[model samples]
Structure formats: C-alpha cells, structure tokens
Target: MNVLLVGCGRMGGAMARGWNGAHRVLVFDPMAAELPDGAERVDSLDAVEVEGELAVVLAVKPQVFPSIGETLRPLAAQGALFVSIMAGITLTGLGDALGSGRVVRTMPNTPAAIGQGITAAVAGRDVRMGDLATVNGLLEPTGQVVWIDDEAQIDAVTAVSGSGPAYFFRFTEALAKAGAQAGLPPALSMQLARATFTGAAALAGADPAELAELRRQVTSPGGTTAAGIAEMDLNHAIDVIVQAVVDAAAARSRELAG
Candidate 1:
C-alpha cells in the first residue's frame, strides 16, 4: 500500500508513525516539522509525481478542506481511497468536496499515538467492501476499528470513545485531590489514583461483568465503599456524569461540523 498523509499534526503524525511500516508512506505538511525516520516528507502536493493505487489520508483541519479538495480532486477522481480523520467532517461532505466516491470518515482519539485508540468509521455511499477492507488494514496498526451503518452514530461515538480519555484523566485528578484531602502525601495520592484507574481499566477490559461483581463484593455491610456508593447513587451521579460528558462532547462535535 502506498499511503499519503495530508497533514502532520498530532493525530496525523501519530497515524503516520503507526502506519509507516505497513506501506510506503509519504507526508505533506507545509510547516516542515521533523518526520519520523524512514517516511518520505514532501513540502507540497506538487512534489507528488506518482499516481494510482494510492491511499490518501486526510489529516488536515476541516477548514483546509477547500484548498486540499481542489488540490487532490484529480487524484481522488482517479480512485484513490480517501480516509479522513478530521473530526465532525461527514462522509457526504468529504465526498462532495473531494469529488470521490470511495471515502471513509473516521474519528480517532489521541490514544492512537500509543496504538491503543478506538476509531469509528462510516463509509460513504460509494464505498465498496474492498475499500473498507483496505482502510481497516491501514488503520489496524493504530488501534481497534469499528464500522457504523448510520453516519449519525459517529457523533455519539465521538462523544464516548473520542473524548472519553480526557474525562478519565479528569476523574483521576479528582481522585488524587480527594486522596490528598484525606491526608495522603501529594505524590502518593497521585500515584494511587493513577494506578487504581489503570488496574481497574485493565480488569474491566478483561471481564467487565466480573469487575462489576468485584465492586459489589468489595462493598461489605455498611462499609466505606458502600458509603461512597450510596453518595454516588443518591442523586444519580453516575448517570448525570455520563450524560453530561456525552452531551457536551456531542455538542462540540456538532459545532465543529459547522
């Protein structure tokens, strides 16, 4: 696979590094930042003299799509499989802008930098199964990928997994603060909070049901864990927190779409 990445910002750079070995990757970013070793770096699309069987990954911002669309319309028309990671950019929008039938719009979070991200993709009307397979293969290096039949679900996916990491980090910080309030040393509180979440996440991944059961088991008769659970359950805190995060993220995603 010959891959061309259109932007080299954080997400783009992460995907470039993750997908480098899977194909011959070329990067085009105007700023000329240092690229990962072994990837070809070009200053502009004019420098790209090759064509055919190329996978074009659009990592550029949504605002730059107009210029990029004009520049790549020819290649896109020639059947390059277009994969876009720009947030809130719909497949229909990308297809209209790029004049391409084979397009996949994806939302990938920062964890992709370390190959642990979860990405959701929606195929355009003209996307074929083969195109999807190729996109999946290319994205496999970065993390897990899921396909959605309804494009509308992408917004929910964005709210959940896309912005989910920052929420976890915030909770971790709060946990650390609470620990400090309980008189633990600052460093120890931070370490405990971080490690607790890490282990819990790992366990949840292994057996989510079992982890829930473990939580129940740990809550003995009128114990501290039970007390905390009671408070958390009193005002439907968990539901409120979950809904608030999802709503805020979805709203932001919609705003970005405009």
Candidate 2:
C-alpha cells in the first residue's frame, strides 16, 4: 500500500519504519531525519506529488493541524484513506477537513516507537469494511489494534491507554524513590522498579486471569504486598485518583476536539 505519512516524529517515524520496505511511504516533515530506504521524505506538504487514492497517515502534532488543514483537503478529496494517530482530533473534525468520511482516528501511545504500543481506532460512519481492514493492517505493525464500536469511547481509550504509559512510568518512579528511601542503592532501586513493571505487564498480557486476581496471588494474606495495598487503597484513594485523572483527560479531549 502507498501511504502518505504527515509528521515523522516518534509515532510517525515508527509507523514509517514499520512500512518502509513493505510499501511505498511518503513522509512530510521538516524535522524528520534518517528515514529507511524505499521511503520518500519532503519538508512541506505542498511538495507531495503522489496522485490517486492513497492511505494517508495523519501524525502531525495537534497544534500544527489548524495551520495546515487546508493543504490536506485536496488529498482527502482524492479518496485517500485518512488514518490519523493524533490525539484530540475527532473523526467528525477530520472528516470536515478532509471532505471525506473515510477517516480513521487512532490513539497510539509512546510504546509504539518500539512496536509494543496498543492503538485504538474509530472510523467515521461512511467508512466501509475494506477501509477498516486497510487501516487495521496499516496500524497493526506498530502494535495491537483495537477497533472501537462507538466514537464516544475514544476519549476513554485516550485516557486509559493513550495517557496510560506516563502513569505507569510515574508509578515506577515513585516505587524507585520509595525503595531508595528504604536504603536500597539508587540504581538497584530503579532496576528493580523497572524490571518489576515490565515483568508484571508481560504477565498481565499472557495470563487470562483478572488483573485483580493476579494481584491477589502476589499479595498473600497480611503480607508485605497486602500492607502496601492497604496503604494505597486507604479510603479507596488510589481508585479515586485514577478516576479523577481519567475523567480530567477525557474532558480535555472533548474540549480540544471541539
């Protein structure tokens, strides 16, 4: 498939890298460098020359879209399948800019740079099954692709998985800090925190059991894990905090999308 990738920053770069040898990928970005072979790069959108239908991946920063939205209308009208990985840009908004409802809005997190990210997508009502399949194929290389039935769910998806990575990183950092405060070497504390997070995530992915069940297995009755859980769950503080964070993020997403 031929794809026009706008903005080759981290996520765009990862997508382009995944599609480099397999397809014809054209990238438009001034800051991108060292793209793989078989991929073409241009500094400006006006320089794009590919005609006919194409799979266009919109990865430009949200701040940059308003200034450049007009430049893409022509391509969108060319019947290009627009797959957007930009956050806060709603399907209806993209369809308005593109003059085509064949748009797929996706939320891919930081881990996509390493091909482990989970990307969620929602298509406009006009999007057909083939368009969805193509978009799925295009996004699958970066990580897992989950299709949302309702566009309303994208905001929650954004809050949960989109911003979820940073949350995990912050928790890991806190764990490291607490370990160091308990007298472990700083480096050792960091290593332990990092490894524990990675291992737990791997198990979470591999195991079909509920995450709470897994936690229960590690948390013996009145053991160290139980004690830590008790402190974290005091008055359900952690749950409240998590809900607040997600709610805030989703609210912001709705605001920005409008």
Candidate 3:
C-alpha cells in the first residue's frame, strides 16, 4: 500500500513510523522539521504521484484542511481511500471537501504516540467494505480500531477516549495533591500516585474480570479502599462529575464540527 500522509506532526509522525517498511509513505508537511525513517517527504502535493493502491491519510489540523483539501481531489479521483484522524472533522465534511465519499473519519487519542491508543472510526455513506478493511489495516499499527455505524456517535467518542487521557492525568494530579495534604512529601506523593494509577491500568488491561468485580476484589468490608470509595461515591459525586465532564466535552466537539 502507498500512503500519502498529509501532516508529519506527532500523530502523523507516529503513523509514518508504524507504516515504515510495510508500505511506501510520502509525507507533505511544510512545518515538519524531520520525518521518520522509510517515509519520503514531498515538497508539494503537486509532486506526489503513486502508481498502485493508495490511501491518503489526513493527519493535518482541521483548520489546515480547508486550504489544502481541494488540492487532494485529484487523488480522490484516482480512487484513493481517505482516512482522517482529525478530531471533529465529520465524514460528510470530508466528502464535501474532497469530492469523494470513500472517506473514513477517525478519532485517535494521545496514547497513540506510544502505540497503546484506541481509535473510533465511522465511514462515509459510499464507502465499501473493502475500503473499510483497508482502513482497519492502516490503523491497526497505532492500536485498536473500532468501527461505529452512526457518525453522530463520534462526538461521544471524541469526548470519551479522545479526551480521556487528560482526565486520567488530572485525577492522578489530584490524587497526588491529596496524598501530600495527608502528610506525605509532595514529590513522593506524586511518584506513588503515578505508579499506582499506571499499575492499575496495566492490571485492568491484563485481567479479564469485570471492572465492578475487580473493585469488589479490592474492597473487603470496612477496608480502607472501601472507605475511600464510599467517600468518593457520597451523594453520587464522582458519577455526577464524570457525567458532566463527558457531556461538556461532547457538546464542545459538536460545536467544533459545526
């Protein structure tokens, strides 16, 4: 497969590295200082020419698309499948801008930089099964790929997984602060919180048990973990807070798409 990656920033660069050796990659990013190995940089879209099966991965900023999208119509005309990782860019918007309906809109989180992220993808109306399969192949190198039927669900995905890592980081920060207030040294508190959260995440990934069951396993009656969990659940506080955060983020994602 020949991949035409439109941007070479962090996420773009990561994808290029993943596709290295398996596919021929041509990147077009004016601001990229350097590119990953096995990826060739093209000065302009006009100079890009691929002879075989091609997939144009739109890794550019949403704002940058309006300026360069039409220039990619030629590739669409050449039957290239379009896969986008730009947040808040709808499949309809992509089809309209590129003059093709074989577009797959995807939202990948920051963890993709480390090859542990999960992406949610929705295909345009005219996209074929083969095109979707091709998209899955291209995205698998980054991490997991889930396909959704309705494009509207992408807003929620953007709010959840796309913005989820920051939420976890913020919780870790708060946990560290709370530990420091409980008499631990600040630096040591931070180290403990970070390690604990990371370890829990790894465990969650490896364990096949239900999350609620995992919590049960950790919380014996009247245990410290149960007491802490009780306080966090008082008045359904944690649930309410998390719901608000996801709702606000989803609303903002819709606003940006509009």
Candidate 4:
C-alpha cells in the first residue's frame, strides 16, 4: 500500500512506525527531525511524486490545517483518499477544503504514540465501504479501531476516549495522595497506587464479564472494598462526576469545531 503522510509528528510518527516496511510512505514535513520506515521524505508537497493512488493522511494539528489545506488540496484533487487524525476538524470541513467528500475523520488519543491507543472514526457520506478498510489498515498500527455511522457521536467519543487518559491519570494521582494522607509513606503510597491501577486495568482487559459484574466479584458484601465503593458512589456521585466531565469535554469539542 502507498501512503502520503503529511506531518510526521507524534501521532503521524507513530502511524509511520506502524507502517514501516509494510507500506511505502511519501512524507511531507519541513520540520520533521527523522523520517519513518520506508518513507521517501520530501520538504514540500510539490516534491511528492508517486504513481498510484495514495492515502493522504492529515496528521497535523487542526489549527494549522487551514493553510495546510491550500497546499493539500492538490493531493485530494489528485484523487487520493483523505484520512485525518486531527481533532476538532469535522468531515464536512475537510471535504469542503479538499473538494472531495471521501474523507475519514478520526480522534486518536496521545497513547497512540505507544500503539496502545484506541481511535474512534467516522466517514463522510461520500466515502465508500471499501475505503474504510484502508483507513482501518492505516490506523491498525496505533491500536484498536471502532467505527460510528452518525458523525455527531464522534464528539461523544472525543469526550470519553479521546480525553479519557488524562482523567485516569488524575484519579490515580488523587488515589495516591489519599493513601499518603491515610498514614502511608509518600513513596509507598504512590507505588501502591500505580501498581493497583496497572493491575486492575490489565485484569479488566482480560475479563470477559461486564465491568459492573467484575466490580461485584471483587467487592465482598461486608468488606473494606464495599466501604470504599459506598463512599465513591454516595448519592450516585461517581456517575454524576463522570457525566459532568464528559459533558464538559464534548461541549469544548463542539466549540472548537466552530
């Protein structure tokens, strides 16, 4: 497969790393410090020369995309499929700028740099089903891939998955702080928090049962874990807090899209 990678930054770099040796990549980024595997690096879009149809990946920050589109239009006009990993840039906006409706808009988190991220994607109305396979293949290197039919759902996905990592990090930090306040040494508290978080996540990944059921299994009826759960769920506080967080993030995403 041939890929025209436009911007080899963290996410782009990760995608390139995933495609290494498996695909021939034509990259354009004046500021790239290093080129990825099997890449024919170019300083400008004009320098790009390839024979077959290519997948032009828009991996640059959304803010820079306005000007970038002027240079990138030719690629779209050249009959390439557009797969964008930039956030807050809607499929309508990309299609309008590129003068092509065959676009795939995706929101991928920072974890993608390590191939552990999950991406939520939606294709433009003009996109064909076959085109999705190309998009999935391109993103498979980063991690898991999920599709949505309603583009609007992408905003919710952005709120949950796109910005989810930071929420987990903050919770882990607070948990460690709470342990230290409960009389444990600071170093020991942090170590315990990190280990517990990591182990719990690994277990959740391995378990096939529903998350709520898993929680019930770990929590004995009259144990300390039940006490902790009671505190966390008092007045449905945990659910309310999570919903609030997602709402705030989704609202911000909508604002940025405009």
Q: What is the lDDT of residue 136 in candidate 1?
A: 89
lDDT scores of the candidates, listed in order: 0.85, 0.86, 0.93, 0.89
lDDT of 4 by residue, 1-258 (tens): 789898899889889988988788888888997887678887788766678768899988888889878777777787789999988899989998888998999998888888989999999878887899999999999999999988888889999999999999899999999999999999999999999998988898899989999999999999999999999899999999999999999999999888
Model 2 whole-model lDDT (C-alpha atoms): 0.86
Q: Per-residue alpha-carbon lDDT of model 1 for 133-217, expressed as tens digits?
A: 9998878867899988898888889899989999999999999999999999989999999999999888777775876697897
lDDT of 3 by residue, 140-168 (tens): 87899999989899999989999999999
lDDT of 2 by residue, 1-258 (tens): 679888888888888878867778998887766775677977777777775558888898988887878898877767778888888888878888778898889988889888999999888867878898888788877889998889898889989999999999999999999999999999999999999999999999999999999999999998999999999999999999999999998888888788
Models 1 onward score TM values of 0.92, 0.93, 0.98, 0.96
Which scores higher on lDDT, 2 or 3? 3
Which candidate tops lDDT?
Answer: 3
Query: Where is the poorest 10-residue window by lDDT in model 2?
Result: 44-53
Q: Model 4 compared with the native: what TM-score? A: 0.96
Total clashing pairs for each candidate: 0, 0, 0, 0
By summed lDDT, the worst window of 10 consecutive residues in model 4 runs over 45-54
Clashing pairs in 3: none
* Candidate order, TM-score descending: 3, 4, 2, 1
> What lDDT score goes with residue 119 in model 3?
97
Candidate 1: where is the Cα deviation over 4 Å? 208-211
